[model samples]
Target: MSEQPKPLPLVISPPRRREKPPRHLADLTLEERQERAAELGLPAFRAKQVSAHYFERLTDDAEQMTDLPAGQRVEIVQGFLPGLMTSLRTMQADRGTTVKTLWKLFDGALVESVLMRYTDRATICISSQAGCAMACPFCATGQGGLQRNMSTAEIVHQVVVGARAMARGEVAGGPGRLSNVVFMGMGEPLANYKAVIGAVRRLTDPAPHGLGLSARHVTVSTVGLVPRIKQLADEGIPVTLALSLHAPDDELRNELVPINTHFSVAETVDAAKEYFDKTGRRVSIEYAMMRDINDQAWRADLLADVLNERGRGWVHVNLIPLNPTPGSKWTASDPADEREFVRRLEAKGISTTVRDTRGDEIDAACGQLAATES
Candidate 1:
């Protein structure tokens, strides 16, 4: 028909290439970075130099790295140190002693870290994943669902950035050192096993390889990933293991920590005991007190009984007041209920303390602010 408008040859265009995700220095291990530099025709030692710049100096700028050859600095920085996190917003409270920053990763994934300064120490709470896979109903982060596991570098970069900020006197009360690192920010630390462990090494390793912080000052928290917990125990690094055990009995724990469905309370507790036996570092039992939910006096007694049965030493209970996320029905227990809960645990000869609540004003609770934005 009309030369059939002989169908023009179909010309298919190649699909547009997807942009590579932004690379943070924290994403690579020392060996991997050395290999990458080799691929770029740079000397093996250049990787160590770059690491020193990023980890010790806390600067990715090639110009600032006087130690590296001027010609090689640009390529090293471009090839190995692409920006990984962008600060979105920061809020401070508690007389500026507590500062929380919301960061957007290269892929638009968001996580947060809080830097709290005390007279004696400074602690940075870091996230192991972009969001949480553990659907703890009361937690804001758990509700957002998991986006992806953070790379080792991504996890370590959070601490490096915080450390840099502290060194520069950016946070309140002038210059300070990052004394502690806690995996209590967002996501389950054990879920992303390899990367989390790699980050731990990078954090505790000596300068040129890591920030060189002591392993003892680091704490890794999990919602009781039984097998992984045991695996961690075998790693030989004695970082504190924090078990988020909200409920003492199986019935409530099963609902509160869905993973309990996979590993029963007894099994989880046994795993923690194994960890204690291996590392000799007392495990921290993290209990978030929610009104009428798991705060009943009887439940507290049951919790103490379980801990006592496990043995008197090598475990401590850190009672946290539920930081109610926006629009959530869960609320913190009344003062009397909280006091009684602690009293019961102590009566059982268990050491307990109410966790100091910080960052309340700035969605300081792990996933609250990020959830709202997402």
Candidate 2:
């Protein structure tokens, strides 16, 4: 039997604040944008135009939004977008197809975003917070500690930035649109529930107000925040919910994912089932495969049993290959063990896949670059 890894540092999550983040137009609704426009002495329609440029056009540069008054372009851009975060560095992989960017927020907090372009579709992995509060021992970001909940605008900005880069032919595939988004980056999204939902709206709502992407294409991941999961289901948004259920049993989960103490494995899976019922989207169980730690064949069977008990076809296991942080005792499981784990789950009639860990040289795992840089 293998010993459980040492418990990592944890942050007691404070209550989510109702206070709004610093001003950026992406944070505002159409009505709010109009109100702010009037207050800024710009015409109400001007707000819509700026939004079209940002959301519809995916470009914040005043020069590109040339239909607007030439002199006023700069003014509106400054007042609305204002460039909330600056790109400190960008590292690429896969022949410049996979790009990871490290952004410095206005307050100097660091977060990361990754853009992966394939032949058929492009996906961008975005961070919901500067750092994470959920102390998942194997996660690099969780180990670092939570910095602050990213604003709705801050979250949307990452998508817009990635989209803009794609449109600019910066990536290998010349000028394409970002088709999918995964909240699998830095923070536990549900921990910052309100802003993440707002970001979802900003990403999926129709043009002039949002990027107009489909809700089905968007995925919001959580560390099993039960109430928030229920709240999100009621929101009528059917974005895919990915639960970070790293372990299937409460005892090991309690040690691997400290939040399991608050929401047990049984209750967490129950919440996930509820989400699937409400949204009609299958819940993704994200289990990070670690060497000699929670990666045994029996654990995989138990995971399948748990999901099967919930019912088949409502849950899919996404086995994420762990990217161990520097000097970490835990590491990814061996290929043979990983294959066997997958076989056990499939034999139980549970769908499973070993996720593609892209951007290896660029530190693909969340918070690695920022954690190292900071």
Task: Estimate, for each residue in 1-374, the C-alpha lDDT of model 1 and write its tens digit.
Answer: 01111221222111233344565556677778878888889888888888888888888778999888887778778888877879998899899889888889887889999999999999999998888877788888989877777788788888998899899998888998999999998998888898899899999988888899999999999988888999999998989999999999978887787787777789998999999999999999999999998999999899999988888797999999988988898899999999999999899898999999987788889888787777
Candidate 1: residue 169 Cα off by (Å): 1.1
Best by lDDT: 2
- How do the residues 1-374 of candidate 2 rate in per-residue lDDT, one tens digit apiece? 23544543334454454444568888999999999899889889999999999998888889998888898889888888886889999999999999999999887889999999998989999999878878777789988888789999999999999988888899997998899999989998988887899999999999989998899999999888888889999999889999989889988888888778778899999999999998789989999999988899999989999889888899989999888888898899999999999999999999889998788888988999998998
Segments in model 2 whose C-alpha atoms lie over 4 Å from true places: 1-21
Model 2: how far residue 206 lies from native, Å: 0.8
Model 1 TM-score relative to the real fold: 0.92
Please report the TM-score between candidate 2 and the true structure: 0.95
- Cα lDDT computed for each candidate against the true fold: 0.86, 0.89
Worst 10 residues of 1 by lDDT: 1-10
